[model samples]
Target: MGPRVARCAILASAALFLYSCTFFEASVVPPGFAIVYGVSDYYPASPPISGDSYDLTYPDDDAIDMAALLVEQGFDVILRTNEDATMTQLELDFAEIGSRIEANGGSDTRFVFYFAGHGYGDGMDSVYGSSFPDAWDSYFDSESGASEPTGSGAFTEQLLLHDAMPINSISVQSVDDVLAVLDESLSDDELSDLLGTLPSSMQMVVIDACHSGGFRGSGTAADTIPESYEGWDEGVSVLDTLDAITLYLDYGSGLLDVGASDVGERQAIVISASGEQEFLYEGPVYGNGIFTHYLLQTPAEADRNFDGLVTANEAYAYARDQIVRVENEFFFGEGKFVPRVSGGAVDFVLFEAR
Candidate 1:
């Protein structure tokens, strides 16, 4: 939508399953380039809390599969899974893509960025003995709130990279800094000129993780979960939950600012796995984040009209419905997750049906 500068922290709990960002409307751009990443393991080699393993079962698989899918769609892809999906490597890959795009006559480049792994929104404090990276000390304060211990509730949501620790992960600001690096490399005039010729440049980002919706910013009252729900166990506070939880569909507050645009169209679409207050699961049934499992099925299972082509909206509706249905059947309507998509009228085509 627009640009957002502040954010609030989300209250999250360690879940038994996995935890785990959108596009153009109607018009399908030819396959261009993609950056795919997933992490099934992390640093420190242990869970910050008991029973909370840094190791996940399906994220790496998700990344590899998603990359393969993009490849089938005719996209040039840069894939990084597990240990290779580090922040350092991501930056390098992203920069390389930018350089390559600039060298290739500055044409419009469509980018598909897929990340499946962990997302942390519970602020940057380690309640346990785990030590987080010091770089995050400025943005998250566990005692105060958001940026300051006594400050207002304003903290950036993060997409936990492979090396991410309890209080250390990649934030909106971190992404923005990366974009800024690219922006600084080009003169403002040159960037403006490039935008004039490349109006179709856009990015589609899909994320599967817990509290992933925070990337979309705060939501309305409709996004709040009632305290009466039974899923709030495992040592989470009802009051804190009520205060921190929100659907967060404000695309302005998302990673759009960090897209390939930097100062161009800002046409970035985000698809997130769950609401800010909800937790999503990964089970042996799918061996993928529930949303991703269904998402990968879109070409076949989500083609509701049997059109032989899947649009962004179709994939979202398909995955969202399946997630609700599966979770309802398992939790008996007690625990369910709502998937979210945010961008500007982004109903573009994802792929041809199988």
Candidate 2:
């Protein structure tokens, strides 16, 4: 071949190789660390009564169990549970987790935060609280006669930002509260300012509840429901803003500059059990939140790539497919479960190295 032709061919080959390495088949292996927090029963209150009312205590248990599972796999874990553990306690735990991860070498560390409990949301933003029978109206200050409204409880993500955890994945199994916090936390420029301090890689959030309060019988069963409940309508908009954030981070200027890379390509992945208009079921046999049940059960089988490591994308795809299949087999429903994800490729290994 002529010199000019040979040069062109070599350049083309290099371009193809780079593209394959960056996009087609890229794998990341890193040390894993995690913090799991679960709130089964609220403090200063009796344990939640099962059978009569929905079992509101499972999420916390699931979270603890997941943390333990991670620990068994070789992850450094921080686990906490119960009523005495308020939102503040949870925040403190996350701060510690973040600090430790940073000290251990932030970029090299793969951090995960898992939470399970009652979550409340005001359509736009939601929060996970320490108790069941969450009084949305009372907390959001929607009821005129209610005592001073306390905003939704602390979001674990916000706490991580506060503590400066760099590059992590956060999986939460609260209802609407999960979405609410994501909506609000990612929107607030101040919150972004705090997050900007962390090293950029990827952040994943998994919410297991319907965004719309309109699920046929969801809030109707409780007579003492708070006024803030009004804001939760069925079919409310999905938390699409997260998607926008991912796109912006991928192409837009960095968090510091409009034209330069500011936050690195840090991604935020959100997996919700249902759309804003749907309902996520929690049957007695399911033993835990419907989404959580599916998540715990399905991904184990979907590690199709057999990389011995599961990325955020792989896990969500597995959960999404299995949730729909199981829901169809059991409920024969149109769309009882859905898992949505945003952000770039993330490294989320469900199992630790033995």
Total colliding residue pairs, candidate 1: 19
What digit string (tens of lDDT, one per residue) describes model 2 on residues 1-92?
A: 69999999999999999987777454555666666655555432223244233235476667766776767666678877655345456546
Q: Which 10-residue span in candidate 2 carries the lowest summed lDDT?
A: 214-223
lDDT per residue (tens digit) for residues 321-345 in model 1: 8766666467644356677765344
Question: What's the number of clashes in each of the models?
Answer: 19, 14
**lDDT assessment of candidate 2:** 0.45
What is the C-alpha local distance difference test score of each model? Answer: 0.57, 0.45
Candidate topping lDDT: 1
TM-score of 2: 0.57
**Model 1's TM-score against the true structure:** 0.62
